[model samples]
Target: MTHPHRTSDPGVRARFLLAATAWTVLVAAVLVAVPLTFAGRLPDPVASHWGPSGRPDRSMPAAALTLFALVWLVVAGTGLVGLARARGEIRRATRAWFAAGLGWIGGFLIGIQAVTIAANLDRDGWSRAASLSWQVAVVVVGAFVLGALGRLAGRLGPDDAPPERERPGPLIDLDPGRRPVWVSTATAPWAVGLGVVASAAALSFAAAALWGLAPAGWSTALPLALAGVVGLAVSSVSVRIAPEGLTMAFGPLRWPSRTVRLDRIERAWVEWRSPVQVGGWGIRGLPGRATIMIRGGECLVVRYTSGGQLAVSVDDAETGAALLNALAARKTA
Candidate 1:
């Protein structure tokens, strides 16, 4: 049998693509028109960068800057649209977030371009351009406000019906008095290697700061150290399944963990998945699904009674899924 929520709908996909295309075209038009409208007033070279003191430090040709901004907006819009389309039938919340993100980026670029033009209006040269600190701040704030509005607009339409997919595997035979538990660990050696490299770099920077070789090295070292810690944390996770349900702990400390109670689980199944299928590695939150991916291959997928699903990549996913399904069945029976 197939679940209604998991079935793909063509209408939903078409609407998303159409909306995305319209937004992209509209933003592209604004970016192009604003500059050409004020071409006579703007200097040949416009101020594109400002130093810490708010003085224009870098300048680019007016035409080139406009072209660059348009290119950037198109690329970003296309990427967001492609990702959404690739996910097929997605949840309304996810679509809203994606729309808001695209709106914010497009608005931000357009606002910055407009501000730059205003700053350079009737200027003798790039050096005489007005300081844009306050104007840039206004643009950022306005972009965020527009993004929130876009999110609301995106949610106005009806939500797509859940897609259709086959149900979980056959139940396992279990003794009435017996309790079975499954445990496994998933790890990514590449992530661990990256973490080690980052840690090494952080230590080098810290030593340089201590020796007064690079006085501001601490600024760089702190962020690197934090990234290293995060990489290590996500490099491995321990998964446990028992009569109580499923529990997943990240890293050796297991401080940050997630648990799904047996009562909430409606079904369990094993599916082969890759990183690209659910965005890149790490913890991925999609439309109606959440994935904890390490080295993706066979993933144990759990569907909650509330219609949401979670998938985790680990060894012996078939056994883990079968055992979990049996436990869930027992609970319901």
Candidate 2:
């Protein structure tokens, strides 16, 4: 029989716990694994020698950084799922995740200090302090970046898809339950597309630079770098339901817009991007996996979830919920 308070399935009961436990356990296991394999503790001393063994090690700590990253992702997912299920725990769960982030940063900083101490038995105070400061730059800067991503995710936080929103009255005559229309951004497609192109172009330029092909003029790489900076700053665009087909905004950033017909929209929803396989964010599959970091949970991959998903990052995600609800209604009807 259907439940009373909850009209729809709330999904698994221990979802939150499961997500949290899985992450925490994974980190603990890794922390244990690191020291065992490295034989030398993390943040190994910044070496001054050229010998492979004596070189300042970066790979280990970078690998270990995954622990902090995994924890953040798990917590973020947990927080989002829980918040969707019930607002009662939003604040509490958010705190736990935030603290987890800070804790990870703190632990990383400590690890760096430990490395310093282990490497130098009696380094002068200034030396140790100076070294530690550099470590902070790596750890803390990354922490803030992740924090920004988290904030964006929170901004797109989901709400209970209004039960009635799905079911419109007969007057609309369109599908009754059909709700939510994918919306678009105002930014130009070029701006957003250019950002992606810019990222690739910048990487290519870097490769060129490494090959000693750095140009002496603006064409050398300035345009590519400039484009990338603009692209990153340009924001992303999206298409929601519309009379024509779907309305697309250039980005969360205000810009020109385009409305493509629903006929053109091949498909939608989150999926592992690249060789496109519709699945969860960061999900991997037969083809490959998503390269983009979908901090905003539940990305709407408009068009077929195949062949390099369009990176139409969006905002005011209530728009997405509306779009999904519309699609669900249409599907059910």
Task: Estimate the TM-score for candidate 2.
Answer: 0.32
> Best candidate, TM-score-wise?
1
lDDT of 2 by residue, 23-91 (tens): 445545555554445443333333321233343333233244334445545654554353444322233
TM-score of each: 0.66, 0.32
Would you give me the overall lDDT of model 1? 0.80
**How well is each residue in 1-333 modelled by candidate 1, as lDDT tens digits?**
656554344576568657867888888888888898999998988888888888899999988656845575667665654555454455566667766876888888888888888889999999999886788789999899879977886665556564376465646877888778899988899889878899999999999999999999999999999988888888988889999999999975775988889999988888776664565678898746889888768888888898888999999888888888889888888
In the predicted model 1, the residue pairs found to clash are 4-162, 5-162, 5-163, 6-163, 6-164, 7-163, 7-164
lDDT winner: 1
**Residue 299 in model 1: lDDT:** 87
What C-alpha lDDT values do all the predictions have?
Answer: 0.80, 0.43
Kindly give the number of clashing pairs for every candidate. Answer: 7, 26
Which stretch of 10 consecutive residues in model 2 shows the poorest summed lDDT? 271-280
Candidate 1 wrong stretches, greater than 4 Å:
1-9, 25-87, 121-127, 162-170, 174-197, 242-245, 251-318, 328-333
